[model samples]
Target: MPEIKTLAGNLTFTECPRWRGGRWWFSDFYTHAIYSMKFDGSDLQKEVDVPSKPSGLGWLPDGRLIFVSMKDRKVMVRATDGTVSVHADVSAYVAGNPNDMVVGSDGVAYLGNFGFDLEGGEPFSTTNLLRIAPDGTVTVAAEGLHFPNGSVITPDGTLLVDETLGNRVSAFDITPTGLGPRRDWAVFGQPPKTMHDDVFAPDGCGLDAEGALWIADARRGRVCRVKEGGEILETIEPGTGVFACMLGGEDGRDLIMCCAPDFIEHKRIAAKEAELRVVRVTVPHSGLP
Candidate 1:
């Protein structure tokens, strides 16, 4: 593990961190805004305001910013001139909030969502992994996912999704029409039997150059660098609950983590303890975030 350092602090809750065009960009749930800042946390700017709350972030081939409007269950796009519009609506296919997403090289975005009312204490259920084409066509990419959250696309075109409640990372081959059959990329243990079972609840993740994944273990309050077959290469205890992470810097080796005291909606909405932390690692980033 490398030395952990704070890059930014006093946020409400940060998610969907990304490094692009020489700056760090992320969504603050309680603040209802997206922010960008330099590597050292200087030049901080609020990039956009998303009233429905934003969760995932990505870019189109033509440079438009596409993001998940979590509450409305829609994917919204921002143009270079700062025009925002709904790109695709996924409310017809999901029951809970759409969380994280990974846009493929060809401009197709695969999105994940919470299966039930997690904060409301509803019974756990499964949801679909959705595919949104560049033309705004919405379809189901995969199904029966247990709270699909953070996702990444490998150089070889494999989509790896972190199933937070499943206790596993699921993989799928990115095909022309949609995704291939689902398989386990990494399994920390059996699928969680209930909400309180001790498990490795992976949240947001980033892929390293060596094909390993740096996963925010939401339930453990730590980040684990894991290999394909379930081997954890490194464990980073940042002393807070990490919900999302990204690998990006001038050299593409900086691991940026989204940290907070906890993930409860009421607690996070009432406080400003969320932070962004960084740790430099040996491996650079690999593919789509």
Candidate 2:
């Protein structure tokens, strides 16, 4: 059995756990804040606060941090002195709020959207992925996605995007020009007629050195380690709300999770309780943020 441990708690909805510079960086969704802490929970610091909600996180090779300012449909770059500036204005292409993002090795960032006004109780819809180059150029990477959420880039430069409402994970080959084509990397459940029928609602994801994906299944309350074509290798139950996860630690085998009682914005904000939990795994992390 994998032994799970709590690193921090009493947060306001944590998502996007990232391992960088020997620390864990994440975002508190409703609180509109970004944070970083040591693996043992020391030296905790609030990095930045977005006026709008924040979710996915990425970093350029030069050490600049970029986070998805969900409501504004923009990715903000943070300088060393704490100056946050708009790196990409994606409003022209995105109809809904941006969600998870991954920074490619080529300094390109791929972002996703919620595809519907969930907070406003709007019906679900399909959205596409946006590619933001280092030069701030934005273009469509993939389309017709059912709420693309967590994503990661493999050592070979393949992009894996988890479609939360679509019950599948999509794959793409990223190049200097743009993405090549879309393929089904993993299919956990059947094609749901509607988003409401999704079973393994894959959320945030992380890649392991062994080419396996550790995905957070929100509706099922577990972190599932799956291989190509949707083979379930293992499952880690957190017994709470698991929104996102990452692999990082001294040896890079630490599997961390963002845990709370629920994902509803009202409940998370009102409850004011979330935690970062970790477990030791055999496979060290591999791939881009």
Candidate 3:
């Protein structure tokens, strides 16, 4: 177990954290706002107000911030001067709202969607993984995902996407144009839970220097480290409802986690009032951006 910290007190549904420009940037889905702060949780700044409920945050090769606009199922880009624009409109491809994302070294942004209205009283299996080019072109990378969530590209450029409702993480080779053949990188249902998210249940994720996948197990309240061959190496039990995680801190070796132990009950009463919390653990490898 690691020591947890309140990066910002009682955030209204926070998810998707990324490190950029020597700061930690994240989003509050209900608040529809993006924020940044120092490593010590100081100098918090409201970077932008994205009305579509921003979730994931990424960066372009040229230093522009790219984020997922969930309600619209689109990817948006924020320039250095803070201008936001639609990078890709993926409504036609993704079955539901976009959730989490990861940017590749080739400058392409890989995004996932909610698949169904998890909190809107209607649940259906319809989600897809999408890719957005540097020039704002949108294309369907993979389809039929139950609820695609967090994702990351390997150092060799292979793309890994966590199919939340599917209970498995899938891998695909990234080409100059789009994704290649899909393969199961990891699956998580041997030990089943009655109240698990219908999909994979894995949410926010990142890549380790040793090519391992660090997944935030939302329903299980733990961070699982999965080997490339789909083996569970280690698990960090937060003992609370975990939402997301990112490798940050001074050396990028500190694992920063976003948790809300009361999210399940909170969502039932009001989907917008979910709390935000974070924790840190010292690890061996720094994470991918």
Top model by lDDT, which number?
Answer: 1
Instruction: Please list the C-alpha lDDT of all candidates, in the order they appear.
Output: 0.92, 0.90, 0.75
Give the alpha carbon lDDT tens digit for every residue of 1-289 in model 2.
7789999987989999999888999999877899999998889999999889888888887888999998888999999998999999898888689989999766799999988787888888898899999978999988899999999999998999999999999999878788888999999788777768897999999999999999999887899999999999999998888989999989999999999888887888787789999999999999977
Compute the lDDT of residue 17 as modeled in candidate 1. Answer: 94
Q: Model 1, 38-126: lDDT tens per residue?
A: 98888889998999998899999998999998888899999899999999999998989999998877889999999888878899888
TM-score of each: 0.98, 0.97, 0.88
| Rank ordering of all candidates by TM-score, starting from the highest | 1, 2, 3
What shift in Å separates residue 260 of candidate 1 from its native position after superposition? 0.3
In model 3, which regions exceed 4 Å deviation? 190-200, 262-287
TM-score of 3: 0.88
Ranking by lDDT: 1, 2, 3
